[model samples]
Target chain A: MNTHIRVAPGDLFGDGVFETIHLRPDGPWLLHEHLARLVRSAAILGLPEPDLSELPAFTGEDIAVPGVDPGSDVPRALRIIYTGGRVHTAVTPIPPAVLRERRDGVRVITADLGVSVRRRPPWSISSAKSLSYAENFAARRWAVRQGADDMIWFATEGYALEAPTASVVWLAGGELCTVPPAEAGILPGITAAHLLSLAPSVGLRAAERMVTLDELVAADAIWLASSLRGLAEVTELDGKPRPHSPWTPRLLTLLGFPATS
Target chain B: MNTHIRVAPGDLFGDGVFETIHLRPDGPWLLHEHLARLVRSAAILGLPEPDLSELPAFTGEDIAVPGVDPGSDVPRALRIIYTGGRVHTAVTPIPPAVLRERRDGVRVITADLGVSVRRRPPWSISSAKSLSYAENFAARRWAVRQGADDMIWFATEGYALEAPTASVVWLAGGELCTVPPAEAGILPGITAAHLLSLAPSVGLRAAERMVTLDELVAADAIWLASSLRGLAEVTELDGKPRPHSPWTPRLLTLLGFPATS
Candidate 1:
């Protein structure tokens, strides 16, 4: 957590993009996909493509070195930030709230994000994971103030969208599904996409389709997926209690994440 | 620009607030109003209140001294940024583009921001001038790609809001007016406010009104007011040519900015 980084004053305006990877005992998981997305996010922000050649390799031996942490077995969060001027990398312990949400499930609510899926502006950066995250944090804070663990956003048309920092993934009739990112103009969720890709191996079908909030509420299970939390089940949505699905532990194991978080 | 700044990794998330003052040969302009707005922005972002007692004095002698530029007559942009953890100050020359826009008028376009004026969520940060400026910059880029200099945002209801980085002010029938910030849910413009306050001195009536795009188009003159670019006349809007405003120089002079920019 103690590190020194320098950036120009112009960089403070959030004209950048970032990626958060799960640093595991085996090294950073899904490294290639995250890096590729980092490049895509940078382009969406109109930033020059970062030079990946200068980045340190995410090998297990390199990760075991003392500069970041001296051979610590505990997993860490690896963050790569790219402003137009500099590319910065930092590693830190995962927040306790992420672990809590992953283990205990989340009390979820639904809020109208006040956006129309039909009329997104041409310069829309919703599909890019840019660093202008104040609105995202503000949304989460508003959710917490409402006595909820987290909230999901729905468009004006009643179409279910994603969360502040996670993608919505749900199970319905043995099919694993997530909202189509490009069509919905949302950041493509790496973890949710990876989970759906693994669904067939778990004997479940995978698909990307738009779902209304009411239809989503009727699904067997709903989870918020991200790199850090992995998956947090929506145990209670909009004050309605949903019984824990038996598939929670099975899906976590399928994703190579410990069910205990 | 050669100074160094240190910040925590968490500060990169655009969770802070900032103020850009038009530094003058005498001192920073509208110091008290800018500081008050900075505090208001901080509160909207849920950041701790900034302590003004620790801020440096804004005296003419201090400004004339070498800490910034000894005996320099050129105006500088004085920026005060505040994260919950720290307050940072920096001085730098204004961008050449701002000066160019002020001297020469800007070609502006109108776009639907896709945000509903009536449905902004409880945690909406639209009124707060937070550092989450990626979308703002992105919107302006979109305008440039469309062969325009800048863009003005309008609500889905067709009511004009504000520019990406400036306030929309127009003159009609000897009246000076701008969109009401609180009602429109946009950041209040410091320069626009100051100018409107001095409208009586210029033999003009000042008011706040929610104007539609059509109504704005019929106005006698339109200008985008900001700290650095005191007043940039919108000479061309949405491909339609507008006559050069004779009041541009008068308004700029009234605001204490050089008529030549």
Candidate 2:
């Protein structure tokens, strides 16, 4: 990716939508799903339909893209950012910390998002992956300061919603579950949703649930799911240690991530 | 000002702070107060103190800077955007719509912000002029689509909080009042505060108080206060027409804005 891009000052105000995809040797994982979401997000912001014809087209199964080095074992992060006026695409190397988190798991905390799910503004854009991420970044920074690697956000009344940058996924009563976006009023997570759809193949039932913090703590296993991280096991939640879940490697491999990690 | 700037891809995420000042022939309006708030906002985001020493030093009163035209009658819009890593400043001619809004008044509507002031996360940046303004822009876009010129945001319980890019100020009984930033969890409006401080000189008392939407509708006169527009009287509220407020001109002139609009 270029180190710098030219932009009008107004473009810096975060009035845009973007998606990050895991670019493996076989091309971007769930590329179609991510593109579809980008369009939905743009509509929510009243932005024009993005012209994505320039992208390589594929059907059903993922294929090796012309851009990727087939010999390379490491995956890249492919990002597409679209405002009303422009679309920018960049391919970047995945960070070492992301890989490390997936390998060793993360320490987590829960915080109230201070928003009312029932009273969301008629024009609320919280469900879109918009570029206004200062608060999201601030929340993550606060978690780091509190000595946790990450945090899960809940609406007032104690319902677990999502992490600052990931989706909350857990195993409870032999079912694989994630929060439903519309009810939770959060960005729909492509990684988590796709993982749950594949749960049946791993002998697990898929479900969408609204779990409270206490309920989440009592789950069999918890993970934060995202594009690059795949699934980062929650090793510790709210200062309490949890045992390693054997299902971590199984789910990672199911999502096309390196299972050994 | 340059038409475009160089920026890293990460910089476009809106993890920054900004301030827009009304740059009159006498220089930036409320320059000191704006700078002070800018620092306070940076601190809220855990950013380092912005190196503002490069800006022309001024004390007490605004002054004509070496960069502005001495004979120019029109005031420019001066802006400062800081993102911990960099500070950028620009000066440009004010837009005609801002002038028109000041002169003709605006048709306004109110919407629920869906946030809880009491339950707000400890890392809330609502009191800071952070650059994550996608929702603010989205709200304004929604208002325009509904055929209104601007909007006032309210907390879930009907408390009138603020406008998308301005502060809520109104005349109640004999007092000139604006919403208190700390209580409302809105950004402290430099223009509104300065206007209130000068109210006593105009034979009116100043105050900061919370009022509900029903109470706001009954106000003698209401105006949205900001740096560029100065004061935009609400000509209509929620489809109900309002008579022109006689004090609009008086307040504009007092704030160094042209009384003639």
Candidate 3:
């Protein structure tokens, strides 16, 4: 499953878009939402509209794995990539760090991304799920080196934008809130958006708002939400440790994930 | 040759670095300088130091073409790519647009990159010549779509930076200058830096300083410098047609480029 795929040499220059979806025995989670975002990302990059007809076949190959071994909890991640030269799709096991952060929490840091949200250009790709993710990876690496698990980026004006690989979600004043993706010029978080939509079912109001770093630090709880990690709670921020949030397990349940151990 | 090369599927994710060098019948122009930048870029991305013993052999294969045909002026480009899994080297003909711009000059525009240089984060990779170049390509595509050949990015503080794929060079008061790459947080341009190093021989002083957009527009002459396109004069800027400067040909010649036709 960890096999390499062929691509035109030029296609590897990061002039493309991609999407990662959580795969399960039943089907890919939020399949349509992920597909819609993939098309949106492609348009942002001016790449030709991708042909997604082959994706269903690729995802269906191991949909019945759980039936053979009900107790096995294997994690599979499906990636669909669209480049100037071609489209590539693959499924691989989710990495161990992702599962650990989801079950156990993550320590986080804050850093200025050096970008000004109010001065965005017409060609800005920050909102697109672009394949130019080296900066994001490097930011995370820097956080790891600083003895943290992830780093949340902020605009120059002191508002939290998003984490390198996930959307920032928090609880404040009895409401579930996440950063407004459009205003922040970041990728719209599929998991965070869906969770917000379901917040009322759990007796909480949902919101998309700009939260300052101070406000975020003062919030009841914080988590980084993405496709693979669902929500990795911010266990420690800056240098201060926070007690685990009781809502972590309840929200995981609402999202149809097994309760955090 | 325009042939495809196989790569690991993960390699196409743009978590790598690359250098594009101008290939000549005699040798790759600025081979050592390009390699030195390659190492710097790799270190910025945390990739292992690359092995370069094979580059000389790769460049030597077709170095004797002039003896077989004296009138050949085919432009070749050599690419060296180092990814998480492998190193790839290839030689291909230079794109016609590159040659055209070098010969006929270019029309350009300036836009805010939305980055605040004064608040750069510790992990910012803006200086790395990374494979994560979707933003650069997108920026150029945007300029081209707006009826210009390329765009020069400026910082939020109004100082001119570099073009998406090239360095901004200008002449002012008998001195040649480019934006200080380290201070500007940009890829150190091999062509621009080398041209400046050779400025004394051409009776011009070399300097690296921060220049505002107004100052750049008021310069005696302006050009975009890169490996393949040695110097493309700024023929038009912000929709205002600039008269071709006689120095365009002289500077090109100073940079070891043939006189513009």
User: Tell me, what's the RMSD of every candidate?
Assistant: 1.9, 3.7, 2.9
lDDT of 2 by residue, A105-221 (tens): 999999889887888888999999999999999999999999999999998868998999999999998899999999989999999999999999999999999999889999999
What stretches of model 1 exceed 4 Å from their correct place? A64-69, B60-69
Positional deviation of A140 in candidate 2, in angstroms?
A: 0.4
**For model 2 chain A, where is the 10-residue window of minimal lDDT?**
A57-66
User: Candidate 1, residues B10-83: lDDT per residue as tens digits?
Assistant: 78888889999998876899988899999999999888899878777866654432355556666678888887
User: Would candidate 3 be rated incorrect, acceptable, medium or high by CAPRI criteria?
Assistant: medium
Candidate 1 vs candidate 3, TM-score winner: 1
Candidate 3 residues A123-200, lDDT tens each? 999999998888988899999999999999989888999999899999998899999989889999999999999999
**Where's the lowest-lDDT run of ten residues in candidate 3 chain A?**
A62-71
lDDT of 1: 0.89
What is the two-chain DockQ of model 3?
0.77
Query: How do the residues B202-224 of candidate 3 rate in per-residue lDDT, one tens digit apiece?
Result: 79999999999889888989999
Residue-pair clashes per candidate: 0, 0, 0
**DockQ scores for all predicted structures:** 0.80, 0.78, 0.77
- Which is the leading candidate under lDDT? 1
State the fnat of model 3.
0.86
**Any idea how many clashes model 1 has?**
0
